[model samples]
Target: MTETLLVTGASGHLGRAVINDLLDAQKVAPANVIATTRNPENLADLAARGVIVRAADFDDPASLEKAFKGADRVLIVSTGELDLKSDRRLKQHQAAVAAAKATGVSHLLYTSMPNPEPVSPVLFAGDHYGTEQAIKASGIPYTIFRNGWYQENLFLALPHAIASGKWYSSAADGRIAHGARDDMAAAIAASLASGSKESHVYTLTGPQAYTTNEIAALVSEVTGKPLEVIQLPDEALTEGVKAAGLPEDFARIIVSFDANTRSGRIGMVTDAIETLSGRKPRTLKQFLEANKAALLG
Candidate 1:
């Protein structure tokens, strides 16, 4: 009998990517994997492909326990609910951690941010840090993946900035090691399949770090669109992001990422991705060059 693996938030980008890697690259039998989401309908295609689909809402502990049952390992993809007024995300993460422990899951894994310091200025820092604490306290053998910023996150700001010729940010001279989302997903899948009983913490990151200006230059070179990093005060950057039609909360969150970057918190680099996946992660330029058409458009 194959050891079952439960993956939460399976409808999301990272979750779906990890499922694909597990099935295709790692050759994990589809019947051995359980893909959990709040809405199982969203994963109809995956279910049709022989992968088990279950509804597991982070906010719903019963569903999490049901979905997590019989799994040898579980990957808790951190929730994205960013309500600063309350500890909603952290609570949801804690619920999942609790469910994993209650269901007797042997090895637990989590996708967390790089350097999830308690005092970090980033708005989402507390969520990951709190979840990490809860996982440690649960006494389950766990692998905490301190994932870096995604190279693909550039799409959030860079495209519009390219169109307007100004990339507003508060990152200053700080560098960011941005691994591709697919690369990170593959690494996570590899670790989940490794069947290691020993607990480990891995900081997954790009091969190298690059400052905002350097990244802007790479974008310019790839898309043939001249772009410049326009550093702004944190307040001004937040306002500008909101002015561009983003929600006030989301805009503020984006600005916090930049502020964290400026504080030198997002610049950490590591070879964990390559070491775990057995493949060198894509460089920033490589990611940029491959997505040139989309970036240009």
Candidate 2:
């Protein structure tokens, strides 16, 4: 029997990657996969491929429950809501969990961050931590993918920094590892389709961890660009981004990532990717080499 696999946020990058892995690599039948998105029309390609596409709006509980019906495993790709003043995302996740339990889903999965603790400088920690706790309390076997930062995240700062020949940072001697976003998706698809009933927590990460200085050197080596690493204090980091035209609140939140890095909350590594997917993850150097054109432009 083909188990029904419902993936939320199907229109997003990660969700689409997971569904593609399921169909192309995992060899799961298309009829067994349910792709849920707020706009069903965005998944026309998936629907054309015989995937069961449904409309699911996280903010509306009734729609979530309706979309969750008759699924064996459901992957709640964490919502994109990041409101600074409210718990909108956490509430949405809790509602999804409730809907899953009510619909009799056997296995549940969630994509979360590395360290979602109260002491972590990142304000969104509570949102993920709360969602994980909700899944545990739902009385269902669950798989929690504590996903780390992505190598593509470098695009947010590296290109601009390399262009100017200087990279600013508040992460002092802090090390961190980043998984390729698509590789993480493949590992997740493998686990979801494995038909396992054991509850587990997997921290999917890159093959190695690198500090700011090390990554700067790697970037310089890869692009042959003369890049300088400028370490700033937390306050200076916030002020720097604010001066760069970001709002003060958003700047502070962005600086919190550096503070979290400095605290070493996200530097851990694991073999969950290969262990689950049976494939080696791409290295940072390879990613840089492949995307060098985009980085330079």
Candidate 3:
């Protein structure tokens, strides 16, 4: 009997990419891979492709149990919910762990962030840190992929900055070792399929760290548009994000991310990605060049 590798959040971008990498890079048979989401209908194509499709909602214990049944390995992609105080993500992670334990899953893998210190002040980092603690206590053989910032996040502010001709940020002059999301996903899939039972934490980051000004220059170079980087006070940045129509709470959380970056909290670069994937990560210039058409459009 072939061992099945189950991946949650299969409908999301990272999740879907992971499933593809498992098939393409690792040569894992699609028949032995299980792709799960809250709505099984979303995965109809995957089901037709011979991949097992199941419905699993992090909030629903029974659903998770059903989805995880007979799985030898599992990968829990962190959810995107930003409201940390509500404990929704905690409950979801708890359900995943409980289901894994009950089903006798051999290995559990979790996607997390670089939380060198629990109180690093990144709003979302706390949730990942807490989940890591819980996983350690669960007594399950696991791997924690502490993913760094993604270069793709630049898309969030790119269009406006391109049109306005000014790059605004609260990141000060601090640098970020932003890895590509697809690269991180590939690393996670590789780790899951490798079948290593020892608990490990890998900090996946890009080959180098670059500042906001450097990124702005790279964007300008690729798009042939003039751009100037403007550093703003954290308070002003938060207010600006809110004025631009983002919810005040969500805006504040993003501003906090910049503030954390400014404090030099997330500036560490690593060779972990190359070590795991056996290839150098795509640089910011390479990323900008490859996505220039869509970025300019």
**Could you say which candidate leads in lDDT?**
2
* Residue pairs in clash, model 2: none
Model 1 misplacement above 4 A: none
Q: Candidate 3 lDDT, tens digit per residue, 1-297?
A: 567999999999999999999998998999899999998999898898889999998888999999999899999998877785687876788789899988989888998888646678787676788788888888999998988889898788888888899978989888898889999888888887887879899999888888889888888988999989899998898889999999988998888888888888888898888877777889988888888887776
Q: Residue 175 in model 2: shift from native, Å? A: 0.5
- Once fitted onto the true fold, the runs of candidate 3 whose alpha carbons sit more than 4 angstroms away are none
What are the C-alpha RMSDs, in order, of all predicted structures? 1.0, 0.9, 1.3
What's the ranking of the predictions by TM-score, best on top? Answer: 2, 1, 3
Report the candidate with higher lDDT, 2 versus 3: 2
Per-residue CA lDDT of model 1 for 1-297, tens digit only, reads 568988988999999999999999999999999999989999999999999999887888898888888999999998879898999999999999899889899999999887887879888898999999999999999999999999898899877889998898899999899999999999999999889899999999998998899988888888888998899999999989888899998998899999888999889888898888998899999998898878767
Q: Number of the top candidate by TM-score?
A: 2
Better of 2 and 3 by TM-score: 2
Least well predicted 10-residue stretch by lDDT in candidate 3: 115-124
Residue 47 displacement (Å), model 1 = 1.4
Instruction: Report lDDT per candidate.
Output: 0.91, 0.93, 0.87
